[model samples]
Target: MNERELQQLTEHISQQFFGKAFRHQAVFNDRLKTTGGRYLLGTHNIELNRRYLEEHGREELIGIIKHELCHYHLHLEGKGYQHRDRDFKSLLKQVGAPRFCTPLKTVQNKRRAEKRHEYICTGCGRSFIRKRRFDTSRYVCGVCKGKLKWLRTTDSL
Candidate 1:
């Protein structure tokens, strides 16, 4: 949704669930990574990750709004507003709001680059670590003209 729609949705959620009005602004933050939404402690404004809405749809967006509203309402009232706080937990349970935003599955499963591999000489029993894989058939041990056996892959030094 657009910024205007986001603002309206935030306000609507705040009023519907918290029984209070959201006086501060609500806007889509493109730079937000990992988190679905965040409440600015200093400004009392809420910034939502637009990717969350686009990927997860309206229901997930509403949950994030409610979760953020929990923080917003509790912090504004001088109650425990942080995730670990008793008041926050109780309010979340009462409102049936999610305790934490569901993380994007794609983000969680990102593959890291392979960094190292271990190779051993079949004849000499000597081991070698290389950053890149070498053809086992052509490459032979310097110490002995023995076949190279692939062992295991490692991340880094």
Candidate 2:
């Protein structure tokens, strides 16, 4: 859907679920990487990740809209709109909105597949973990002036 459809959907959802009319703009935002949606406190606009609708369908999109609406209504009313606030939590439960958005599958995989390169000092036998491979010949152990040798690489979440 386009920006106009998004705005209309947000307004409809606001009225249906929150008993309020949304007076701010709602648009699909391609730049949103990890978040499903966000309510801008300054502009009172709601930015939704387009990938969410394509991947999770309209149900998930509606949930995200509700979540953002919770923030919008609370902030506009000068009530606590943060996740930790009782007002926010109460509205979320009342509206059936998710407390947190699910992380994008690709993003989660990239984070879980982190690699660590291990090296050991020849003289002191000290072990070090580095994120990237290094030139062992050019670098020495921080202590004992020992030559560093590649040990093993590990991958972990």
Candidate 3:
């Protein structure tokens, strides 16, 4: 749906679920990455990722709106609006809103998993897997305190 429809839907959900009117703007933000939607702390406006609606459908969009509304209402009331807060969690449960939105397939596909670097201790013959490479001369093995040698680098599964 367009921004107008989104604004109307957000207002409806806020009133229907929280028994409060949403006076701020709700717009589809194309710049949003990874997140399905975000509640702006400054303006109290809700910015949603349009790609989420396109990829996940209407129900997902509704859930995202509900999630954002939870933040909107809680923050306005001066309660705990962050995800870790008790108020936010309870409100999310009460409204039947999702804790986290499902990741978009396209976004998931674009992210590359971190590669692991394999190393072996020359003296102890012990294998080590690290996220980043370290200098063999500076660092020694914990077991035998021996020099380390680079073995192989593999993509993390």
Candidate 4:
């Protein structure tokens, strides 16, 4: 569906489930690579992953909408809107919204194959692993405070 359709559907779901009208926007965001949907706290908009609909169909899409709506309504009403809040949990159960968005399998697999940069202390021959590359000039080995050299980077998977 298009943006207009998405907005209409979100509004409909909000009224039907939450007894409130959704005043903010609802749009499909292709940049959402992992989560099925997101509730934007700043703009109070709802962003959905179109790929989720293609993969899981209309029922899943409705569930995602409901999940996002839970965030939307509670946030606007000054209640607990975050996932961990008791108010949020109760609202989710009341509306039958999923507690967590389903993670995309492709994103999960890619995350599992994460690589890390390896570093070794030249003086003590101690090893260190970091998820990101860091400047060797500014940092030293934690164990011996010696000069560090770049070692072979490796993937964890």
Candidate 5:
């Protein structure tokens, strides 16, 4: 759906679920990487991750909207709106919103499958793992001062 549909849906959900009208904009944000949605405190607008709707479907999108609405409504009402607040927790439970968004599998897999450069000491057979590739010729083993060689990298952490 477009931004217009999202705005209408947000207003509908706010009235249907909370018995309140949403007075601000609700739009799909392409820049949101990890979160399903976020409530902008300054503008009182709600930004939703379009990836969420594409990956998890309409139910999840609604849940995310509900979650952000919890933040939006509570913040506007001058109640405790933070995740740690009792009011936020109660409202989430009352409205059946998820406390946390599910991690995107593609993102999680990319993190888990990071390429780690491994090195082994010839003398001690000790292994060292690093995030970046390093020249073994310039660096010696710390324990035995032995020559180091590049080893095979693992697929997962």
Candidate 6:
């Protein structure tokens, strides 16, 4: 959804769940990498990752909104608003909000199974992992200065 829709949704969620009006702005932030949404402590504004909506749909988006709203409402009321705070936990349970922001599944999988190229030293028999392919003829082992040979490929999950 667009920024205007996001603003309206945040406001609606705040009122419906927290019984509090959301006075600050809510917008989509494309730069948000892993987090579903974030609550700005200084401005009391909410920034949501647009990818979350596109990937997970409206239900996940609503859950993220509720989670951020918990932080927004608790912080504004001078209550414990941090993730570890008792008041934050209580508010989250009351609203049925998630304790932690849900990360994008693709990102989580990518992080868990980062692709790596395995190479072995011909002279020393030592192994090395590189993210990018290198010219075996040009590059040598750092430890033994021996020729590197491609061994196998593995996912570093």
Evaluated at residue 116, the lDDT of candidate 4 is 94
TM-score of each: 0.72, 0.84, 0.83, 0.75, 0.82, 0.72
Q: Residue 78 in model 3: shift from native, Å?
A: 1.7
Predicted model with the maximum lDDT: 3
Between prediction 3 and prediction 6, which has the larger TM-score?
3
- Residues 108-155 of candidate 2 have per-residue lDDT tens digits of 666757799999999999999999999999999999999999999999
| Selected candidate, larger lDDT, 3 vs 6 | 3
Clashing residue pairs found in predicted model 4: none
Tell me, by TM-score, which candidate is best. 2
* Candidate 3 lDDT, 48-148, residue by residue in tens: 99998899899999999999999998999999999999999999999999999998899878888889999999999999999998888899999999999
Q: Which residue pairs overlap in candidate 2's backbone?
A: none
Stretches off by above 4 angstroms in model 2 are: 109-115, 133-145, 151-157
Flag the better candidate by lDDT, 2 or 3. Answer: 3
Q: Which pairs clash in the backbone of model 6?
A: 112-157
Residues 1-157 of candidate 4 have per-residue lDDT tens digits of: 8889888999999999999998989999999888898988889989999988887788889999999999899999999999899999999999998887667666766776778999999999988989999999999988889999988888887
lDDT of 2 at 155: 92
Query: Any idea what lDDT model 5 has?
Result: 0.92
Task: Give me candidate 6's TM-score against the actual structure.
Answer: 0.72
Off by over 4 Å in 1: 109-111, 114-153
Give residue 76's error in model 1 in angstroms.
0.6
| Total residue pair clashes for candidate 4 | 0
* Model 6 weakest 10-residue run by lDDT: 106-115
Ranking of all predicted structures according to TM-score, beginning with the best and ending with the worst: 2, 3, 5, 4, 1, 6
Each candidate: how many clashes? 0, 0, 0, 0, 0, 1
Q: How accurate is candidate 1 locally (lDDT)?
A: 0.90
Give the root-mean-square deviation of each candidate in angstroms.
6.4, 2.6, 2.2, 3.2, 2.5, 4.1
